[model samples]
Target chain A: MLNTEALAGVRYRENDVRVFEELVRRYDRKLYNVALRLTGNPDEAKDLAQEALLRAYRGFSRFQLGTSFEKWLFRIASNLYIDRLRKQRNVRFESLDEPVPTASGQVEKALPDWSNNPEDVAEQNELADEIQAALQSLPINYRLAVILYDLEGFSYEEISGILRCSIGTVRSRIHRGRRLLREKLAPYVKPAAAAGARW
Target chain B: MTCEKAMSLMSAYLDKELGFDEFRQVELHLAYCEACSQEYESLKATKELLGTLRAADLPREFWPELRERLGAVAAEERVAPARAKFASSARQSSSRQPRWRGILRPASGGGGGSLFSSPMAKALVPAFLVLVLAALPMVWSTRRRPAEAQVSSRIDSIEPYFRDYVISEYDRPLSDKTSVGFVVTGQAVTMYTSDLLGPSSKVTRASGLREASPLPPNTAGNEYTLISYPR
Candidate 1:
């Protein structure tokens, strides 16, 4: 269980070390899941999650008393993942202005489209690898936005706080991130499957 | 709304982030435009696909390793401040001021006061001072100065081994010439010197060793002396 009081009392030492350990353990599963989705590898995810937790513990002094611990932890995980990507990003060049290829073997300036119905996609019958590959294909920021919103079920406001951006920017990132992800997952999804999703 | 504009907002529309007027605009537009409607549907589908990526269980051994690493981190954070504080307080004790004063000492030289200064820096400075004082005992322990018993008479001017002791302990460079001078006035021992630069040599107050030995009664207030240790 997450010892909220112990975390709140981070400045105080009377709280047993076991309490802090329990606090980290409580959020381990969630952070691991979010990290796994972001990195697409279990080993990398584990490393990212551990680093995020360690950073959070060190920086606990700045954390306010009443704020959401989960969101704070998520911000650390997301930022670490983004920071790692940024270091490696300079090695290769990818211009978002350039056209992205579509499932139809065509090229366009904007994100591509998925032929499958939204209902069918949400049904959860596909292999995990298909979704993992699609997520990894997205640019780091876009991948984070989508993962935070859909995978972690964070509110736009919470994501804005985590990413340290305006709500409008969060909305735009989530929108664009989902669009690109849909384009990537289009091939894995089936068309003409009784499109239950309407605009 | 036009197809391009409506499609741009389709993502927000699916997210229900649109306000009343914008939502109405998107709703009215999506009611008629099949392309915009299809885009919104597919966009939602892509985001939903992420929900299916399940979290895998970590190996049992990983937890123990992580816990051990965390313990190490905790120990470091705990020891760092305490070490710096104790060293700083000890250093402050050697000075004429009461040891308690060091704890309440102003962190900044300016009138900004200690309250506004960094708590961490304030805590560590005194601890660092303590390490500086350790040179006196270290010299005796290492037997660097065989006649070290007489070194403690004038605690202020630790000439022979202060610089070497500090450099050895801190493992850092020091100024070429470290000249510290002291004058005993009644019960108050006043140590005064400013960026006094001279060639490295054993120097006393009057000429060389004049001020170092007992001062002559005739020497007036105008006469200032320094103890200079050769580097």
Candidate 2:
């Protein structure tokens, strides 16, 4: 069972390591989901999610009581992801920790890497890959708004705070982003359906 | 409402961001308008398709690894003076001003003076002072330097009028020529030599070379100094 109060209590510890672990256990999945949608790389998303959690833990004393912990956590994740993207200046998803494995089972030497894990379920894998490819094809701003709203289920207001845009602008970006995504998925989606896949 | 108008606002309406009257209008139109309804459904379907794109989960080992890395970092942070250094600076800053301004307020009022009245106003005062103190020298220099083009234009216009005049020759007994200097007394003594000296470094005219010397008592002897200094 998830007890946010207990988690909050743990997070409030001056420097208690166990409390931080519990905090990590609580939001790791959700943050990972949001990061994956934003970045569209499993390894980068994992690292980014971890980074967000670690940052939150470091600054946990600032967390407001009686408000949505999830929202606060989400804000941290979204901000970190946006900052990382800005710093990279058009580069995407090359993890410092893990690299693409080559023929000799050694990591490939490259700047911005695009690699897929072979272990995921095939249909889920296809959906994930197509989603990533389609996401990358969209403009970065549109991609951020759409991912924050539809996939991660952030409200327009929350997304505005996270993306630092007016609610009206956030709505329009999500709408336009969805339109472009639908057009991009049309070809890939129809072929998959024709092969008897439901998604 | 027409399909275009309804379609245009469907995104806002779906997001529940429409103003009350706009929302009502959309609801009323959607009750009877099949075309608009179909368009809304299509847009809704598009959103659903988008929702299928999920963030990939990290491996089971990933969090543990991150925890280890962060633990090491936290341990290092514990021993390092970086936090202490920041805290000391923060203490000095806070001591210099009030502390309540750091707290979050619902409405940070636009009446600028009210910000200082804030409980945290003391802290903000020091921070603000620090910023101003840091900026003062830069601001002073920026204000002190005359605009280059304006000075250049003034020089260009003033130069031609006086370029022809010169002391024909300093012919006299050395004592008489030395005694020929005037002793003009006024607040401003040393003038810009460039005003009289042409760009070629020749003293073409000395119109404002005081009829009487304004030279102070310490340097009352030599009066032939016409050095050009930059503005």
What is candidate 1's lDDT per residue for A1-199, written digit by digit as tens? 3555667675436443556667777778878888888887778888898888888877888777677877788888888888898897679767767777778875757666574786677555356777887788887777888788888777888888888889888888888887777777777544333334453
DockQ for each model: 0.25, 0.15
- Model 2: per-residue lDDT, tens digit, B96-174? 7655554433346665544445668768878989999999999997885576445445655544333321132222233
- Candidate 1: regions farther than 4 A off: A1-5, A10-15, A89-126, A191-199, B97-231
Candidate 1's docking class is acceptable
Residues B1-231, model 1: lDDT tens digits = 899888878777888888889899988987777777677667766656666666678656667777777777888878888999999998776776876666566655664655425778778878888988987688666785444334434543554354344223222255433344455443344443322433354333324232334554635543322333333
What's the alpha carbon RMSD for model 2? Answer: 26.4
- In model 1, residue pairs whose N, Cα or C atoms come closer than 3 Å (at least 3 residues apart or on different chains), thus clashing, are B87-B126, B87-B127, B88-B126, B88-B127, B91-B130, B204-B208, B205-B211, B205-B225, B206-B211
Instruction: List runs of model 2 lying over 4 Å from the truth.
Output: A1-15, A61-67, A90-124, A188-199, B1-4, B15-20, B31-35, B81-231
DockQ of prediction 2: 0.15
